[model samples]
Structures are given as structure tokens and as C-alpha cells.
Target chain A: MINRHKNLREKKGNFWEERLGLRAIINFLRQKKVPLSEHTIWLYTGSLILLFLAVQVITGIVLALYYKPTVAEAHASVRRIMTEIPLGWIIRSVHFWSATGMIATVFVHMISIWLLKSYRRPRELTWMTGVFLLIITLGFGFSGYLLPWDSLSLAATKVGTDIPRVIPLIGGWISKFLRGGEDVGADTLTRFYLFHICLLPLMIFLLIGFHIFLIQKLGISHPLKYEMRGIKVPEIPFWPDFVLREARVWLIALGVLITVAIFFPRSLGPQADLMAPTPAGIKPEWYFLFLFQTLKLFPSQIIFISGETLAILIILLFLGLFFFLPLIDNQPARKKGKIITAISVIIIIYAIAMTIWSLFE
Target chain B: MKFKYSCLSRRRFLSWLGGGWLATFVCSLIYPLFKAITPPYREPDEVVLLIKEVIELQPNSVKYFSWGIKPGILKRNDDGQLIAFVGVCTHLDCNVQYLPEKRKFFCACHEGWYDENGLNIAGPPPKPLRRLFVYEESDHLIIRREEKA
Candidate 1:
């Protein structure tokens, strides 16, 4: 049978060879294991992120068909789509909430992986790529929010873009680049539209491709405790068992998306009037709420150093630690999951508390 | 390695079923986006009034109909003459309404009002109501744009 298969492979070359390649792949999957534990549920977070991303891509592309990116046309076009187009509101709402959903799943997925200590050893690049994905996803959010050109979106965007200006040396340049000059205007719209629809999408797609490739290359990591105990655990086949489970979860997520869209259709605020005083209660989208609130808490200056600058720099420092996590946790003589656990706990608490505080405030 | 998958597992069947639903959802979503991209419909150039007869329209009565995407009103005064006006309030472009009780067209936005003659009476409407050409042809009233009103 092997000889016959080899002969057919030789005769048909690459095409037939590919047909016979399934067994090798199947055997690899069959040999591979993702250990089952009480913690196995967290494994679905990555797939959930992928599913939400699929939602964003589909709805976003559809939205692009009707959305005009220019300052004059943008708000009216969104209004036109909502009022005139058939079920366009639902698509827009789904796109909006799905973005929130995507960011959330990313947060959960990152924190879960960190708590699991999955960034150890061979998964270092996976973590790095994931960090990139997280940042790009936020980039997606910030840029997309301004596309509607609403009063509230405009106010929040001003606050968001102003953050990079506090970075000192390249601060003004970064702000200028983001806003396309001195301030947010028509040029800012064009720049953000390019970033939202063009550059950020490209970057996230590449990063996601690399991240998933790495995940598959080095299969899902078991918790540190699982490794420490040297306990043998049975794992189901990745192709059928795990994939079907993921599919089931995706269905649930879809139902959730539909429910949210039906009950809470996203609203378009009045067109941005830059000449008017900014609205009093304008806040950034929920994902940025934590940072938004943190910045709000800063004093004007701490002993001549801008307190806002200090707060931003401190956050950047933590981000740096997260970026170089694999080296810090894995490269040393002693593998330090304990330090990771402590940091993860602090980050989670800070994020949730700040998020809730921002909501109330 | 030999492969044997003669039996269809329950999970596999469920996955396929769920996958089928997702595929349907995606298609339903994408088709509408495609449909929405077409040029927004314009109402016929001339809206021939089929619902009400000119005889049925008593003096001081109002009739409303859509002209393309714009809202229009045909107000018949005590003289039994028809006066047609675009219902858009000039201030913020909100749709104005015929408030026969007040004997004026009232804009809820900024409390702007136009008198029965389509002249701005109260508040922030900078211009008078726009007039549309109205003529009766063979027992049917048709509305068309006046080239210069």
C-alpha cells in the first residue's frame, strides 16, 4: 500500500503528494495534546477573539460601502445609512459592539495566558506578537471611533490623540502625525480613516497571522502548576474534539452579538461642531476608560515634572515589562511564574477597578 | 497510519449544524450591505395624486405626500385654491408640519413657524417655505418642481 501510494505521489507530483499528506498531518494532531483541566475553558478565549474579529471584518467591510471618510460627508453618510438603508443600523450596531467584544476577549485572553504562564520558553515570540495584536486592536478602536464624525467621538478623539503629545522629544511629531498637523480636522479625518481602514488592518492581519502560526507551531501551553506537578493529563484530538468545542462557543458568541444588537442599537450623535464648546460628559470608548480615568486623576505637575507625563511614562514602563516578559520570566536561572502571577493580579484589579470607576465617574 | 471514520460523531454533527447557521448568518449580513450600496431611490419626477380627489379636498384642508426623498404639503385655503410647499423648515432643515389649529406651518425645532401663506412668521426660519408647482391634468393632481420660485 505504501509503495502504491508512493508511485501515485510520484506520478501526480505535488497535487497527489498533497492528497497523501493528510495522514502525516493527522498523525501529528493525533500525537499532540492540550491537557484537560479545570482551566481548559480559558483556551477558548483565543478562538473567541478570532470569531469577534471575523464579525468586525464582515460588518466593517459592509459599513465601508456606505461610510464616507471625509469630514463633510462622513456624518451625513452615517445618518443616511442608518435612516435610509435597510437594516444598516443593525450592521453598524453589531460592528460597534463587536469591537467592544473583541477588545474584551483580547483582554481576557491575554490575562488568562499570562496567568497560565504560557509565555515561557518556546512561546516568547507568541507573547510578543500578542502584545502587538493588543496595541493594534486598540488602534483599530481609536481610529474607527472618529470615522462617524460625531460630537462625542470628536471630543474623545481629541483627548486620545493628545496623549502621545506628552511623550516629550517625538511627542509633538507623533501628535502632528496622528492629527496630520496642529489639530484634529479634515486632515485628521483622512489620516485616521487611512489608519482605521488601511494601515491598522494590514498590521493586525499580519500580526494575527504570525501569532496564530506561532500558537499552532508551539501548541497551547499548560498552566505552570500542570508542569510543576508532573501530572499526566489526557487530551482530546485537536482536529475534531477541540475544534468542535470552539465552534460551539462561536455559535454562543454569535447569539450574544445578535442579542446586543437587537436590544441596544448603536446611536449616531449630532455631527461634530468643532466651533462649539466640547460636551461636558464626553469620554473615550470603554476599552480606553481605564487609561482615560487614570489620566483624569493626575495632578497638574508633581514637583515641576508633569504628573500626566509621569503617569503615562509609568504605564509605558509596565507595558515594556509585559513586552519583555519571556526574557524576564523564562531566561533566568530560576523560572519566575510567581512574579508573573503577582503582576497579572495587580494589572487585572487595576484595569477592572479603573474601568468601573470611569463608568461611574 | 490507517484512517477509519465511518461513524459520524455527535459533536461533529453539532459542529456542522452550527457552522451551517453561521454561514447563513454571514450571507444574510453581506447581501444587505451589497443591496444598500445602490443609488438611493428617487420618487417619480411627478407624483400623481391617486388617493384624494380635488373635489374631496375641501378648503383649509391639507394633504401630505413624499416627493422623491423630500416631504411636501398641499394646503387648500378658504378660497379653494391649492398652495403647495416643500415641508422642510429653513433653519435646520427639519420637516415642518401643518398645524391647522394655529393656522400656520410649525417647526418643532427652535419653535420656528410659517404662516398659512408659507411666509416665515415666528422664530429662526431665515427664508419662506419653498413652493412646488401643482397642476391638475385629467382629474389627477401632479406635483413638479417650479424652475424658479
Candidate 2:
């Protein structure tokens, strides 16, 4: 059977294949190989992210059909979808869970790449694009959260938008722009709905397309340490072997998503009242917990600069460093590279610790 | 005696079963997706209103209400008669505004116009504004889809 499949291209004057010349693309995929190692499992995380994203897009479209962008009807519309529309709760639940899954997978993929030092010299652009994609994914989460127009969502968005106000010169303008006014009200809902359903999707789609294209063109990166030591990595064809393994992973993920969505569906809170005081324990989504906690830990003022401003500046500094990391540690075999990796590990630990503390508090 | 079914090997059978399971799983999602995408049925056959809401409505003026998800208008004709209209434009679905000076229902969307009597008189409106029968009782008014015979 294997031999017959191998001889297919050589033997056939297949009509469609001849006309379209898809043979080149097919041959490229067949020739493309993935490095088989203990760390190969991390490579599968990208495909998992893709799977969750596809789930998000499909469910999101179905949701938008029922969702109302206006402040007057957004909450009521969501309620109607939950209680009145058939299986609407399931669709919404899946959308929410899939978003969580996608963001989680994205974090895993990035951290694994960092640990393996796969974002070295030739793959700098790949790492940059990955960081951009991460930001876009988070943006999707943040914007989508406000669409429900529940008290919790409104309060969280209020705090989230205010974070930008701590920036230096353009801070006030940025905050106003994000909120579409001085407050998180009617215009904010309209703006967030636009971002969630249209702008963010377009940006993510284009970036994901380019990100995948870069990945395929450069081929999968080998572990930096392994490459430096001249180790021969075992490999398997991406077309059949790697693809079949990924398909199994996708099936398992889908099953888990459906089960969790059904059993632990997200619940909507009371409709947001602009005149009401913010509900207590107001927190952003889980992904933003660490940052939220970090911001909370800062004092009201820090000498000349405000505490929140200082914190935001520091966060921005770290983000800049993270984006330009490949250039900083251009040579992964050096002592500087080891130090950078160690710092990244510490950052991860800090983030986890902060997230847990915030959850408890 | 041992008998073997050559046409159905155990490996092939299991593969077929796996494929069938996957196919079934995919097919199961279709109904929920269809239900979600296809909006709920909400054709408003009639709506009821308090007479006091429109009691002070002046002639050549319009009072707005909701007909299901669409805008509705209750206008008092100059001759002291009440007329109700589904305020959506016939060309598209933009809400029509009553221009008192012109005394015509105007859709800002495409400059579509309907006469005071709800007749399509100008612009892109292919049909007249939908008229609903308004019935006045003791203290309430009922707007129905059918006109009085």
C-alpha cells in the first residue's frame, strides 16, 4: 500500500492535479519533516491553538447572530439566547471555553519555544509574530468579555480601560479613545462589539496566516542546545505522520471542550447599571489576573511618579524586552542566553504566584 | 469447522467503526449550529398600548413605540383620527420619521417618502408603509395586523 501511494504521482495523469499543479504543494508537505524528540509534544500545541481558534470562529459567528451591540438590549439579548434560543447556551459555552483553551495553548506554545530556545537567529521574525498574535488573542478575550454587558463585565472593562490612563503623555487620550468617552457606557459596548467581532478577527486572521506561512517556510526549529552539540534528531514527515498525531490531539481537545462546556457553562451576571456602584471582587479574565494583581500591589504613589504609572511603565519595559529577546540573546549558547532564560523562568513563576494570590484575595 | 469472512477483516472493521464514530460526532453538531444561526421566530402579529400614552398626541405628530424589534409609529391625523404604522421603510428597513412640515413619513436612509395616509409617494420605497388597525377600547388601544372590514 505504501509503495502504491508513493508511485501515485509518477504513474498518474490525474486531471485535476495536472490542471491545478497542486502536486508541488503536496510534494512539499510530504517532504517536510518534524524533529522527533522528547520536546516534540510542545510542537503539537500550535495545532491545538489552531483547533481552538477554529472552534471560536464558528461559535462566535453563531453567537453574533443573536448578540445585540446596543447597551439597551445587549444583556437582554444574551439572556434570550441563553434561555430562549435552542441550544444557544451550548454554542455560547463552547465559544467561551474554546477561547480559554486557545489562550492557554498559545501560552504553552510560547513558553515551550522559550524553554527550548527555538526563537534564535533565523526565527526572530517568527517569535515577534507569535508575540503579536498573543496580544491579539488577549485583545479578543478582553473585547468579547464586554459584549455580555453584565455588571462584572462592565466593571472589569472599566478597570481594564483605565490601565491605559497611567501611560505618560497620551494616556488620557488613549483611555478616552478605548472607552469611546470618559466612561464605560453605551459607546464602549459598541466599540468593544466592533473590536470583538470585526477588527480583532481580521487582525488575528492575517497574523495567523503569516505566522503559519513563516513556520512552514522556515521549517520547525530544532532545540538550540541540541543543534549546538551537533545531535542528529530523528524525524517524521509532516504530511502523514505528524498530521495523524495532530488529528488525534484535536479530537481529544474537541471532546474535552464539549464536555466542559456542557457541564460547566458560563453564567451571566445582572445587567450593568451605569449609576450603580461596581460589584465587589471585580476581576478581569483569568489570563489578566497576574497583571491585575501586580497593579493592585503598587502603592498609590511612588516618590515623583504615581504607582500605577510606574507599574505600567515597568510592564511596558518588560514587554519591549520580551519582543526583542531574540536579538538580545542572539547567540543561545552563550552565558547571556542562559541568564535570559533563567529570568524568563522567574517571570513565569512570578506570574503564576501573582495569579494565585489574586484569585485568593 | 472454522469459517472466515474474507470480505470483513477485523482491522478494516475497526477502522470503519472509528470513521463512523468521527462522522457521527461531526454530524451531531449540525443541528445546534443550524438552530443557533437561524434566528428565532418573532413575527409580531399585534401589540397593545395604554391609551394614555397617545392620548395627548397632537395632530400632524408621531408617537413612537416598538413593534417586536422594529419601530412603530402612532400618528393622529389632522382630522382627529389615530393611525398606526410599522415605521420601517418598504425599500429597506430603516425607521421612518414624520416630517410635520412636509406631513409625509420620511426614511432618512434613502429619502423614501410615505404620504400622511401611509402611501409610498417618493424615493426608493417600493411599497407603502405597513398600516395596522388601531382599536380603541375603554382605556387601552390594540394594534392589529388586519385592517377593519
Best by TM-score: 2
Candidate 1 lDDT tens digits, A236-292: 778778887888899789889889987999999999988978988888888988888
The top-ranked prediction according to lDDT is: 2
The runs of at least 3 residues in candidate 2 whose Cα sits more than 4 Å from the true structure, single-residue gaps closed, are A1-13, B1-16, B42-149
Instruction: Identify the CAPRI category of the predicted complex in candidate 1.
Output: acceptable
Number of backbone-clashing residue pairs for each candidate, in the order shown: 0, 0
| Model 2 per-residue lDDT at A238 | 93
Consecutive 10-residue window with the lowest summed lDDT within model 2 chain A? A9-18
Q: Identify the candidate with maximal DockQ.
A: 2
